[model samples]
Target: MHFIEMQATARAVRAKYAQVESERYGRPWTAEEIMLGFLGDVGDLAKLVQGKAGVRPRDDLDNALAHELADCLWAVLTLADTYGVDLEAAFADTMHALTQHLDDVRRSP
Candidate 1:
């Protein structure tokens, strides 16, 4: 699926989670809570990467790494949506700047 499609799906999933949390905890997760969760996911992803690189031992390495990556992506997509960021445009602009920087550096003495 395209990035936009994936982002839409992520938002839907986030809404579902919020509903679940509200039913269980009497409140939905706040944006700060979501960001904390995202940070945890990122930490797990880093560990999975280390395991994949043989720097650490972990079980179910393949599945865990894939799951962690998906978790991270979901967090990023949802956070961007919450913050009103146009990720597609931001990504394009950032990549264009990086490409130009690399080209300029390559031409330098």
Candidate 2:
């Protein structure tokens, strides 16, 4: 699916979580809480990365890695939506800048 579609799907999942969370806790999670959860997901991703490199032992690392990556992406999409950032444009611009720097480096020597 396209990036926009991925973002929409992420948002829907986030909304669902917020609905259930509000019912459970009397309030939905704040952006700070979401970021904290994202951090936890990142830690999990790091361990999965180590598993992939043979530094950690795990039989299900491949599947877990994919799920962790998706979790990270979902967090990013939700945060970007919360903050009113256009991630697609930001991502494209960043890639363009990096490519330009690569070109300049190639021309230096």
Candidate 3:
């Protein structure tokens, strides 16, 4: 699926998780809490990356890496939604700037 479709699915999952959190914690998670959770996921993703590089031991590295990547993407999509940021536009703009910088550097002495 495309980025918009993926973002929609991520938002849906975030809403479901909010419901679960509400029932369990008396309220949905704040953005700070969500960010903390994202940070934890990032830590896990780091370990998985190390495993993929043979710096750490892990079974099913391929599946674990894919899962962690998806998890990270979901968190990113969710955070962008939470913050009301236009991630797609921002990503495109960032890529354009980076590419322009690279082209300029290549033209230098």
Candidate 4:
């Protein structure tokens, strides 16, 4: 799906999680808490990458890798939404800059 569609889905999922958390813990997760959860997901993603590369042994390699990547993407989309960032614009600008830099480097030598 497109990035905008993914972001909308992520936001909906985040709202569901917030409701669940409020019911369980008496408060919805703060952005900082969400970020901490993201960090945990990132660690899992790193291990999965290692397993994919044969640097580690993992029993649920394929499924786990896909799940972790989705988790990371959800976290990023949610965080960007929470912080009022225009992620699409930011991504486009960043990629354009990188492409220009690479083109300049190639021309130089």
Using TM-score, rank the candidates from best to worst.
3, 2, 1, 4
Write model 2 residue lDDT over 1-109, tens digit each, in one string: 9998999999999999999999999899999999999999999999999998899979888899999999999999999999999999999999999999999999997
The sequence of per-residue lDDT tens digits that candidate 1 reaches over residues 8-108 is: 99999999999999999999999899999999999999998899899977779999999999999999999999999999999999999999999999999
* Candidate 3 displacement at residue 34 in angstroms: 0.9
The local distance difference test score of each candidate is: 0.94, 0.96, 0.93, 0.96
The worst-scoring run of ten residues by lDDT in candidate 4 lies at 51-60
Which clashing pairs does model 4 show? none
Candidate 4 or 1, higher lDDT: 4
Better of 2 and 3 by TM-score: 3
Clashing pairs in 2: none
Better of 1 and 2 by lDDT: 2
lDDT of 1 at 10: 96
Give TM-scores for every candidate, taking all chains together and pairing residue i with residue i. 0.94, 0.95, 0.96, 0.93
Model 1 stretches with alpha carbons more than 4 Å out: none
